[model samples]
Target: MEHDESLRFEVLGPLRATLGQSELDLGFPQQRALLALLLVRAGRPVPAGEIVAALWPEGAPASAMNIVRRYVGSLRRLLEPGLPPRAPGRRLSRGADGYRLETAEDEVDLLRFRGLTRRAKREAATGRPEPALRHFVEALDQWRGPVAAGIPSPARDHAVFAEIERELVRTTVMAADAALLCGTPEHVLPHLGRAARLDPLNESLHARNVLALAACGRQAEALAAYESVRRLLVRELGVAPGAELTAAHTRVLRQEVRSAPRKRDLARPAQLPPEPKQFTGRQAELDSLRTAADSSAVLLTGMPGIGKTTLAVRWAHEAAERYPDGQLHMNLRGFDPLNAPLTAEAALRFLLPVLGVPGHRLPSGPDALAGLYRTLLSGRRMLLLLDDAFDTEQVRALLPASPGCLTLITSRRGLSGLVAAGARPLPLDLPSTADALAVLARHIGRERPAADPAAAQEIVAHCGRLPLALAVVAARAASHPGLPLAAVAAELRRSQGSLDALGDVRTAFAASYRHLPDDAARLLRLLSVGCGPDLTADAAAALADLSVRAARRLLDELADAHLVDESAPGRYTAHALLRVFAAELDRRP
Candidate 1:
């Protein structure tokens, strides 16, 4: 937001970056901290000695520099995937001193905060208190927690982080003083209170917290704040409230600060689910979704149980802040076993009321309700997550007319019609071996998987690296932590032709399988008869006892539902789990 660029680094919150509305995963803990350290000291080259020291405070091992080099290489590729082998990429560069991360003006959130603070100071110098306070509020708003929030301990307490925390405290106290000048001290209360808590013994901050709260007409809260700080100071430092704090107490007693009327706060619907728990991997798809944010809508399609909903919901959470008006989520139930897909009007009925529209106020027809929804979101910046949608028409009905809003839709079928329009198509595929192992490790600790890599590979293979399947199987293993991963892999291998161990996986496949046209379903079942890695259209036709042209059509239909992958032109293959599923069905009547 500060640089007006699509991609920027954030240091004030989590150790991460945002590319447009999408947040990039900055790799593991240490790599994230490294990025944070670079951002904190951006544009200044640090010697390798400083890098190693900051990363490992106690001591640097022999492999520390090599590991740092490896992390640097991985980060370069992550930030600029297309860079050539020997290229240093756009952000990080190596000089004689060591490595440095550079940024344009206001490209980092910390830099943006500093810039805002500087602007507020200038405004105050020019005697524009209101504008000064506005800048101060924005500057304070930039903080989510202490700098580089997700960095692990020890490194998190490094002097670099301490320096940033001091900057936060200074700004918070200054903003509080500016708040008094504008008579809207409430705007600065939260920041002041947080700063005071971070530095309880800093009487200046506590005094400002008290004065700000008192100025906002909350004397009781203000007195409580003073008392809390006083006790903390006494306990921690064996010192009572100092002069500034005592003066704050005296002013509160005399009611010297004039109170301002509070502004009414509007509640916006934050309807996206709680951040998609244990969301494992989809970095490329996430990057695609970020690019697709330029479009008003993006369709996420994959076979059932491939985690289309999880990926969409995860991306929605990352981008939710961009849509300040609100975010709306609805499961269209396109493939629900127990219920029919909600019609356009029915879905609108569920949504419009959530946006503060009365039920009785909803229009009678689909077109009318859609019109009202579009009108309500006419100029608003909002996010609509249309999950499990049946088709393009169902999605188009609920889409906002405003360009400022973004819609993310997930479905089993490709929904090519929307893709034919401007919407980007993001097909969520199974994870790679490493990512699949990571998913299992997230549920069951890394030790089990790390100990038996081959067994872990076998388990992922049997599960076809499908996220839902891996999650279910790994969750069972996690429930019994002492269980051997080889035992789990052996069980999965023994149950090869059935999803008995994964009833949920079977259920997900059945939901998509049941929706197929008769010919396509039969072809899928006959897919079990093939022994090669994949089959040509003519070969598949021979197996299914259909004409080559007819087989091609059915294959296309099955591909659209993601039941089969057309691995090559005129060739196709089912995922391992799907093949076994088809084999089981073929054995049936």
Candidate 2:
């Protein structure tokens, strides 16, 4: 037989096996289940009756034996293709009582993961935590995603996988603890952050996280992390924090914990990125933000590339002195095309240290981290700019628990869901002609637009009066001082069919478009192909061949996502750049 003896099997995230350079196909749900059941008990024969029970626990059919035999034959063919027909299977061989999968321990990813975890634990117990920490990292890195992500049932609930997953979590916490003991807790904060989410109710992990945070000199956040555990325990389990957690909280309160040295500690973080040099107009939106200043949170939602971040950053700088503690800024990267939206836990991991938690002392779980964040900000007046939010759930976990901090969140969608959380939504629209002209004047010389006033007005109109589009036009004009405003306007008008002159406009719109639900995405494409300047529900229905009721619901979704504007009741129209991007999608083969 030509089968590779070094065949590898995996059950970490999915059921997969590969030999040499080729991936072996594990066919059919039942056949795959049978293979998983046997592999978990490799080197020991699993009875035919046991196999049937594991694969179909409810009951077994009369032809269950025949089915198992047939599946075994199929799996054997794939596992050892060069074997002659009817030849005794070498990899999967029938025994006197049942069958056994002849595989070595090192050939399986699960075995390797478990082995590293055991070694890490042994090293930690021997007071050699640094080595333990390295093994712990290697063990945790084996997990590709959730356990048996898309595999059929029973295999997921199998005893081996469940035990290993539990072990992985414990190992992760152990590694963090080892790092803490070695005075290098800062190195394992990311791992602890992930494990804490996986096992939120684990009090030992929470205590360890708090200690690490305190060790980083973020005493305020450490105290808050303990309080988070106390509240969660009471709210969910109807109990108080255990002895260790209480001790950690008390130590943080008294400032007696030994914290790691700070390389560059700041009195307060002023992390806000620079705003546009010459921001123009949005007087009305700025006014609304001033009104919402007293509110705990304010959401500024609008279409793609519509100056949401610019407006928020500008206002943050303008009101910098109002927040005496400091300013915090994070681009949630929610609408980023290349990267996944930042999760609440990951965001807290980054923000907590800046707020004063020592790198080693940051909370491990999102809830705990958020609690620590809130505790640190409880009495301090701070400004938090959470830019490019994806949805309410993403925003909810990141909101400060205290009202002393004011959060400014921006999203490409309307985020109506945030209204329930006391967030006042201020939806932004295309800039007015006057405001658009001012933006152009700010970029190009004011005298240039004033010289050819008619052409400048036509340019803003053609760009749909969007600040982003207007800025694109202004940039092209600014690069060539000798170029006339009329010529720049002509280029914008001529390039309407393509995004060559739009400058990141299509890329921005595509980022939001990809996040839409399937029905909304399809409707967006159809609207580009068939809809008009202003479409009523009835007209939209005819264009997409959907019922009026269905079309209205889709339009409402589109409106929520800021993909289209509801000019009046049941009337929708997309921005010029958005329409161009959508039309481009429709033309795709």
Q: By lDDT, who's the top model here?
A: 1
* 189 Cα displacement, candidate 2 (Å): 26
CA lDDT of every candidate: 0.83, 0.79
Candidate 1 residues lying further than 4 Å off, grouped into runs, are 1-267
Backbone clash total, candidate 2: 8
Error of 2 at 523 (Å): 1.0
Encode model 2's per-residue lDDT on 178-297: one tens digit a residue: 666444667767666676776788888887788778777777877887787788899999999988778778767766555322323435899999877979899998888888888989
Writing each residue's lDDT as its tens digit, candidate 1 over 10-104 gives 88877779766678888888888788888888888878888889889898899999999988988887777588986988788888999998786
Give the top-scoring candidate (TM-score): 2
lDDT of 2: 0.79
**Can you list the residue pairs that collide in candidate 1?**
none
